[model samples]
Target: MARQRVPEGPPPAPAVQKVSVRYAKRGRLRFSSTRDFQRALERAVRRAGVPMAFSAGFHPHPRISYANAAPTGAASEAEYFQLQLTQQCDLDALRAALDESLPQDMAVLRVVEAAPGALADLLQASVWQLDFEGVTLETITDAVATFMDRAELLVTRMTKSGVREFDVRQAVLASDVVLVRAGDADGRDLVRWTMTIQHTTPAVRPIDVMTGLTELTGLQVPRSPLMTRLAQGILEAGGRVSDPFDA
Candidate 1:
């Protein structure tokens, strides 16, 4: 086959300014996958009339970079991404426009001039909160105790590459159980499991931690336990997650 001629034209304008955004995925929007958010964001960017930079190739794409997206079916307060723009704009106004353009449940929380580093490199850990209904606080506490005591807890998850196993314990830095509500009128108990986990390859998710708990102590996790990412950033010396935007 003969070599195809490359499309000829002046290259697209280089990015003039880059801004990092922090958004929230809450309520029913949490069920939407990463690709869904990407599509929605691209549309929102157009609707908001932001001057986005594009690639030089024939099929030029928006210069947006996503970092450490939260898993599907989990709500998050600290989802982050960066956008390269062809022109500089007021961060506050851009944030408001984008927030209004997005769906009701997904809201833009913060927009700041990106610092001198990759956003992904700053996100070293995540703090997650898992709320379990129909389970006693004592049961979850015991399970967490058992999970923390073990030196290693291997769990399996089915991926596109088939069954994969990894030690969830190694990624877990700290964990605790709290009683959200004690014996409500419907006789249902709500328990919250808060944990700080280090970001690692094949990232350990809240479901994996629950699976490890079940495996270690025969704890029954609720089928629809609500999982929310409270924060994601650099892991500090005292096991706290520092804001990446503040870096």
Candidate 2:
């Protein structure tokens, strides 16, 4: 009997270094779910030729972790994730490769070496922009004032577990109605609002804030406002959100 030849084994994975990256979800891609983005990222990694590490087991997956994913249907400019690489490489080059591999709407914004602490911990609050049509700025301003003055404003939302109630007032650190234009060129009613909310249990969403506004002043916003996450980071002493990469 002829001796059987030895089978070839898989190459060993290299030691990984953690890198934190900031990306944006603009346009229709903002509607993509976290799982959807993850799949896209995995494909981009392969196309970018990133030397990513893998787990040990029957099935190995790329060692990647995400932090503070925005809700679906919400456009965001400050989404973030941590990627593990098999070896140290030029971050700028990696970012460029990945950006080119991804779609136009889902673009990479910044890449930096991660610090010692957890990435999630760096994201303590978020700043959101809500633009409304068919609503007067005065009405929106009054509603915000009322919501801020109140000690407690409870809002209910239907979660997967069941119905839940939380204090929308406590979650909101600060809010104001901004006037992008005194009036539209068409002279239509419009209101631009910005708010900062802390991360808490049963996170308060933009819809919940709208509900609170309606409950407070009985001013019904006819249509859903365009919601966008302007930034997510640690809320500083003066209501400013500090970027995680700066830390």
Candidate 3:
């Protein structure tokens, strides 16, 4: 057949801009899993009448992307979600709407237009807080210091795929492990601390660190781990710290 010429078509229009909502759940709500949080938010936003942007093709769902999925039974003060909308809306409106619909434990902190290509694009580090009881602050701090000072802190993780060896010290950026008086709970002082951690493959959870600490001490760590992701730094084009949002 003779060679036939084909016409080129113009590039597709840019996708609609969206906003990333930074929220948190503490106290009882903190125990909710990431999936639960997603569902709760979808309902709340739906009731708020936020024009949800659906995905193209089959099985369309609201274009809501959570920055990092928090593990179940963990608590977070800095959970984030990106909500794509059909049209732009007021930040205050979205915030207020979510506030009214959301539970008391979960609250929206800030609503701002997401940066171009910033959705899960820039992930630097995370700040986590762990709480426990009958644990000395000095011992915990010392252990954390040891863990941070190490050149390589390796640990084993048993995933469904299989067990794997990983270095935790590499992922730790800045951590402030302290034993704070977490107020009175049944007439007993509770131990709490905040840990600034870096995220990497085979993500290291606060619970994992706590478990390691327990293993190191062999003192039977009390008060199961309650993790809260305090902040997620920005990851630039080169994985460098660009314009980071300190949450």
Give the count of colliding residue pairs in each prediction: 0, 0, 1
Tell me how candidate 3 scores on lDDT: 0.70
TM-score of each: 0.95, 0.91, 0.80
lDDT of 3 at 176: 68
lDDT by residue for model 1 over 1-247, one digit each (tens)? 9998776898888899999999999999999999999999999999999999998767999999999999999999999999999999999999999999999999999999999979999999999998989889888888888889999999999977889999999999998889989989988899998999999878888889878888788876556689999999999998899999888
Index of the highest-TM-score prediction: 1
**Candidate 3 lDDT over residue span 61-86, tens digit each:** 78878877677777766677788787
**What is the C-alpha local distance difference test score of each model?**
0.93, 0.88, 0.70
Q: What is the C-alpha RMSD of each candidate to the true structure, in Å?
A: 1.6, 4.2, 6.0
The sequence of per-residue lDDT tens digits that candidate 2 reaches over residues 1-247 is 9997643568548656889999999999988999999999999999999999887655679989999899998999999999888899898998999999998899899999989989999999999999888767887888888888989999889988799999988888878787666667767577888999898888888878889878878977778888999999988997889898897
**How well does candidate 1 score on lDDT at residue 145?**
89
If both were scored by lDDT, which would come out higher, candidate 1 or candidate 3? Answer: 1
Candidate 1 segments whose C-alpha is farther than 4 A from its true place = 1-4, 160-162
